[model samples]
Target chain A: MADEAEIFSQLKQAVMEGDEDVAVAAAQAAVAAGVDPQRAIIEGLAAGMAEMGRLYEREECYVPELLVSSEALYAGLGVLRPLVIASGKAEKKGVAVIGVVQGDIHDIGKNLVKMMLEVNGIEVHDLGRDVDMERFITATQETQADLLCLSALMTTTMIAIKDYMPAFKTQLPGVKIMVGGAPLNQQLADEWGADGYGENAVEAARVAVRLLETK
Target chain B: MHRDHSVKGKWVKCDQMTSQERWEALVNRRPTDRVPCLQFMLGHTAVVNGRPIAKIYDDGAESLACQRNAMALYGHDGLIMHGWANAGGAEFGGEIEFPYRKYTGAPLMKKNPVQSEEDAWDLRVPDDILSVGTMPIALEFSRLQYEAGLTVTLQVGSPLTWAGSVYGEERLMIWMLKKPELVHHVLRVITDFIRRKADYWIDRFGAERLMAFDLGIETNKLYSPKQFETFGFPYLREIHDHLTERGTAIILSHICGEQNKNLPLWARLSYGKRGMVSVGKEVAISKAREMFPDCVIMGNVDPVTVQEGTPEQVRMLCRACIEEGKDHPGGFALMTGCEVPPQAPPVNVDQMVKACRELGRY
Candidate 1:
């Protein structure tokens, strides 16, 4: 049997290669070897995702590569999440409610941000795309979410973010609002009163972590 | 209202060139008063007209009015009668949502028709797919715009983009990796349908008068240059060959995101000598002009800046773009990297026109 370090490395390699079966097999083997779930996740899966994120930022990898890697990571997570919870070793950084804002069905960016957040150990409630403003408020209230991440690919749908800011502030005053997408910039985020702006998925996860730390 | 032209610091009556003449002059690299300004401003036009986006998409008359009013307001050289998003996919049984009030949001696919590899076999290109859905409305709008003496550009997605719409993008991504042959099958079907649709339009509207804006070639952002070369270029070549053979003077190619790696392949297009390519914000116009010296480079202005910035800022950006490509031997057109936002300030658009007339002078 391989040692914990070797098993962990194999898991990481699986994720980086975007091979779901290998990731799951390596994860299950690590669990059977009595390797800590948190260690397996952070040192193995999350580490691989971090590398993938770097590749994406450097343009070495594109959206399809990221998508496949995330899918692999989730497959491993599927086999390990309940185990981690049962072991009582799961440490969630924060609870996040993320969605592509009202009238926008473009969710690729939002989906990427969610995957990054999840890999970073944030429990994310994905509201999917074209989400209504009221659903965002309700999800925040129900989940007591620490972060509300809104995404819009189109400039027209982005208006929904601005329209809902006052309402989000009034209703969910403590919730931090994060905005991101192709058309978004830091200046626009400031204009829309977003608590934070993420230019891309990796940056979005970093911003989420920062928002949680400050909270 | 004839705008004054400042040629070498002298105010002169700008030659009243029809939109078509201006486009032709730029394409032919002839001496012109100034660089032409063409915008992908369909959603912005809907906002200017204060019309529901759904109504404009579904009703030809409303779309015509919106396009006409936008030209009247912005004094642009051309107009695009953009139809519902994913109209072809919708015609093939992809469920679509047509929401009102969202000018930028058109009829988007609510459900993809091709769920699995086997589903590709079930898909068929209806004979009247072009006339079905909101396409007829768009065609009618184009006809009206043409009749009104305006240069009408028709925007349609590439086969790969249409395939992604027909089969969900995620599924298509997976297929690209796990089932490439399946992706090829779907792409071939979509290419056939798109080719027929282009032929239909070209036959109805003289190819010289109608410019087919083939979009979605930027799959390079999602796939590698090789993947695009394999799946994207063939269909694009087919359409290009078919259209050019029928005398389509200008075929506008727009790839939404960074396409730096695919620039070489794009330069190899059959009509590269006379066609136009619109690059995204990630590509510099100077670089595109340097690379595709034969093709007319259309744009690189940041649409986000136009949407949120002041008129002065927009003018500054427009001036910068003009300065970058004003001397390119193939010629350049001032345009947004992507569609101008519906809520972009009219003052900013006015400033773009002003910048083109001022700094774009030869």
Candidate 2:
């Protein structure tokens, strides 16, 4: 029988290699070994995903690798997350509402940012793709989210973000707004009154954490 | 020397050659008095013409008229064509929604044709290729281009991109690593469809009059060079070779994003009698010039700047691009790195042409 440290290492390795079966088995082993589910997740599954994110930033890997590794991360989370919740030990740092702005169906970037936020311990409410401004405002208000992240891929759809910003600021006070995508830049985000902008998911997560800490 | 003329109360250099003559000279590798501005424009054309953006994609006659009108309005010299980047979804039996709404730019794939492994295996080229989605409109647009004495255009695929439209991009990408054979199977079908579509266009319009193009998004931001070599390069090479063999006059490939790493593999593909490659701002014009010395380098201007930037800023960038790209061994055309944004200020769009007139002269 593997020790908890060895089991955690196995979980990490499984996710990095994108092997769902190994990830699940290692996670189950952690549960059986009486390791704290939160530690197993943070030290094992999230650790692997963090490394993958770093690799992605360095261009050592690409979207395909990230997609598969995310599958493994989710597979491990499936086993451990429920346990953490049942134990009431899951410590999420902040609440976030994330979505692709209306008329944009390209959600891979949005999805990635959501995953990164989740791994970093944010309770993320994903509104999915082609999300209209009203829905985003409603979700942010309902969740009382600390962060609001919007993504748009096309130049046309990006207009929705700019159009919605004044409303977001007027309606949702104290909520830090972050925007990212292929067509958006820091200058646009700043001009639109967003608190933060990320070029990619890893940076989005980092900025989200910093925003939450500041809050 | 090109003569300077007063137009709209400003001293702008006047073209010694007419647009038609200048375009012909550029294509035949003849010297021109100044740089030509070829627009990679689509949705914006409709905006300028006071029509719904969807008209640019859905109605062929309206699309051509809108484009030609925008060309005249902006004084851009070339690239009068049809089709968008995410093109194959409609032709592959997927449901697509044209951009009728305010924020929609191009057609959106409402559903992907391949939802499962079974669908991937079963995917095939349609028996009636010309009757597929967008084909009739595309043919109509080409017929108009022919009648107007313009270069007839056809949309060929960098098969992997078409496969992404057929299968969802995320699914196709995941399958590349996990189910490579499945990705290859889909690519094979798409490649076959593209070849068949090319043959039909050649048979109808005559290859000499046609400019076949593929909008490739195999950027390093999304794909590694190895992945492009495996999935993007082979199909592109196969298609380019076939088109060249069939005497297609020019092939314009919009290497759509940060594809600096993919340039070597791109360079390996054949371009008919001429090749025109358009790169996004992520790639430097000098690098594009280095990679494809014999092909016309079309761009590196940032589209966001054109839409949101001040006119002088736009002109500054255009002047810089012209200085870098104008002396290429093949040829150079000042253009936006991608589609000029649908809502780009007209003044900003004009700045490109204005820059060519002011500083792009030989």
Candidate 3:
């Protein structure tokens, strides 16, 4: 079995290379080698992603690099995802169902948010665009997830968060919902009846974890 | 930027004119005397300059200031703001996580928020466009701008864009293939809402004060011209006609795309009849002029030219836009096909405007 140090390095290498296949293979190997899946995910992939994000923010990397690296992270998750489940290891500290709100199609930002969370070892169920009220509720029920994260990019569509919460509790009272997006924030989140708000991708995961810890 | 912009020449007061009167002059290929240059007056740009993004949307006064700033900056003969960036389809009713990015400190609605067709059906246009959320606050801000005697421009929903907001771009694209009826339904809702909201603002600001597009195409076409005509045009025409009836002479139809399949149809629409096609570079504005001689056109200069190119390059480009457009004062408006990149060096923008003013024989 390899030490956490070795596996982390390999996982970082795969992600930096933007090789999704290699990232996934390495992540699987990491888990198989007795490195904790969650640690490998959070520390290994997420760290590399953070660097990528920083580079992106700095203009060192553009869209293609960010996208390719995200894909690599996706591949890493794919490999490690099943093991956490098969072993009933509870790999995800908590699950989050996230999506862009209705009346909005913009997703690059949402995808980034999702990937960032996933790399942090949150079980992210992406409810792709224009998700209905029921599906949002149903996904929560199905996953018995810790958090429901909603994203609305459009000023027009963001208002739907108003309806979602009422429906969410009326349907399932215990589920916690966090809504975030470009046009929204902690204040708007509270106004919209969301339990909490995350200002950005990194914050979303941190918030998601905190939400679950309380749960 | 040269520390002082002494706009020493002539500054006209457009306040006395009613919305309808202003609309008529600009829409019918009449010379409004000045181009409409509404740069980042409100919405995202407002958020950029004003208080934090969260507060700008929340505060009525701040939103107004943003709008006024945009108007002041460009002081175009017209103003255009057809819509705003949302968190995504999911927040409204789709699936997305539109975070207020801390790094860039901007907001966005990502694409592919909707996960399925059923989700699309389950959605409706929320009334909050005017009443709830920051939108109503924005409308109130526009009202304040009008009350304060500012020339007005606003945005409305384009069917395709509205559909994209609800269904997610990917799903909407698939809907174009699988369930176009659903796509049309979504479009109808957004179009109707936009029209209704336009009417609301028209009641306040009066219809047709300033010209702006519905921003029919964002980065370019994901739809063919035929599809746009078949699906998008009818709605656009209806809105334009409705606005026209209410005294809106020009409903600028905006597009920034590679394929112009829908452009000719967009050109023919009554609102866009003498109206400007805010075309970005990939499409030939000159060819568009030949195809639709009466239609006004704006933009095609690459941001590179403005951001990095010399004043000479900007001058040359603006000259081309004017020369190719052949209708600057009357039938043409000069502008970036998309919003001027916010970070664009102000000098290039100044150059573009200067060239626009100088190139005209009028």
Candidate 4:
């Protein structure tokens, strides 16, 4: 049987190459070898995703690569996450509620951010695309989420973020708000009373972690 | 570029050319009085006219009227057209929702036409392209432009962007890696559909009078240059070659978002008699000028700044863009990097024209 380090390297390579079968096999080997599932996730699966995030930032890889790597990461996670829970070592960094705002169905950016957040060990409640303001408020309250990340790709739909801001402040007083998308900038996020803003998904996860640390 | 003339015993750059005259001069490669401000706006026009945003997408006559009124109000030069970036889904058999409700901007694709591999294989260009969804509205809008002697506009896809609408963007993107052949098949169908649509438009309105444009969102932020070369460039080249060969006089490509990496590829496409390229803020106007030195460089102004920023800020950005782009040999027009946000302050929108008038004079 391969050693733990070799198995971990295999898992990371599988994710980087977007090979789900290899990732699954490596994860099962890690499981059979009595390697901690959580360690395998953190050192193998999440590490691979984090590398993809870096590659994405450097433009060495693009969204398609990130999407594929995400599938591999999830495939590995599908094997290991339940084991981690059964081992009673599933500690989340924080909870996050994420969605594309109402009137905008474009969720690619939101989805990316969600995956990044999940890789960072945040329990993300993805509300999907064209999410209503009420849904966001309810999700945040119910999840008692540490952070709320909103995305809007269109100029028109971005208005929903601004319109929903005051209500979020009133209803979910302590929950930190984050906004991102192609149309948004740091200035708009500041103006809209968001606690933080990310230019891309990797940066978004970084900001979410920072915000959660403060909380 | 406008020069100072003796007005009331003072050297002042007064109104030197009408909008029509300025547009003509720019297109024909003649000297213009000053920097022309072209708007890449859509839903904002309806908002300014106190109409639902849906009017701008669903009702072509109303879209034209709203746009014209907004143009007159702002005193900007051109680019009055119908259609959004995500345009082909409805034409290809997907359901679309026009922006009638609050917070809705442009039309939204309620469902994609292709959901699975089988659907992808079955996708084809409609036999009657004109009778399909939103084609009638687009035709009516073009008819109005033709009647008014304005530039008739048509949204021809970059094929890849339309494919994003035909199949869902994420699914299409994944297919680009896992099932590239399938992706190419869909792109092929989209290109054929775009060609048929372009032919119809050219047949109806003389190619010389139409501005064939593609709103491309294949930003480097989304796709690698290689991905674009494979999926985007070939289809774009085919369409552009076809348009130029068929005597189409102009093509305005809104190379939307951060597509600096794709510039080399974009510069490779044939742009007919004249080309106009509009870029988002992530791309510098100077870079756009360098890439397409013979094509008109339209923008780099941040639309968010135009929406959320102060009038002074908008003017400053406009001034910066005009200064950078105003001297391109091909031509230049001050415009928002992307679609002007629907609820941008009126004064902020006016700031662009005001900047052109005050600082952009030659």
Q: Write the per-residue lDDT of candidate 1 for residues A1-215, one digit (tens) a residue.
A: 77988987888888888999999999899888888878888889989999999998887887877888888898888887888899887799999999998788778888999999998989999999988889999999999999999999777888788888999999998899999987788988998899999988999999999999999
lDDT per residue as tens, model 3, B1-362: 11223334744233333333434565655555444332322344454464544434455676566544554464333352424443224324443332233222223344344556675565566765565333555576676666776545556656666566666554565456547788787777677767777777778776545443576653322344556666677887888877767776456666655545556666666663346666766778776676556666666775535644577777787777767765543366666655554435656766665554445434
> What docking grade does candidate 3 earn?
incorrect
Off by over 4 Å in 4: B1-12
Note the residue pairs that clash in candidate 2. none
Please give, for residues A169-211, the per-residue lDDT of candidate 4 as tens digits. 9999999999999888897899889999999999999999999
Estimate the lDDT of model 2: 0.91
Docking class of 4: high
Clashes of 4: 2
Give the better candidate number (2 or 3) by DockQ: 2
TM-score of chain B of each: 0.90, 0.97, 0.76, 0.96
- Against the true structure, whose TM-score is highest? 2
For B1-362, candidate 2 gives per-residue lDDT tens digits of: 24577756878867788777888899989998789989988999999999999999888899999999998887788888898888797887999999997689999988999999998899889999889999999989999899888899999987878888899899988899999999999898899999999998899889999999999998888899999999989999999999999999999999998999999989888999999999999999999999999999999789999998999899889988999999998999999999999999999998898788878889
TM-score of chain A of each: 0.98, 0.99, 0.81, 0.99
- Indicate the worst ten consecutive residues by lDDT in candidate 3 chain A: A56-65
Top DockQ model:
2
C-alpha lDDT of residue B53 in model 3:
44
lDDT score for residue B216 of model 4: 96
| DockQ of all predictions against the true structure, Cα-based | 0.55, 0.86, 0.03, 0.83
Residue A182's lDDT in candidate 4: 84
**How do the candidates rank by DockQ, highest first?**
2, 4, 1, 3
Interface RMSD of 1: 2.3
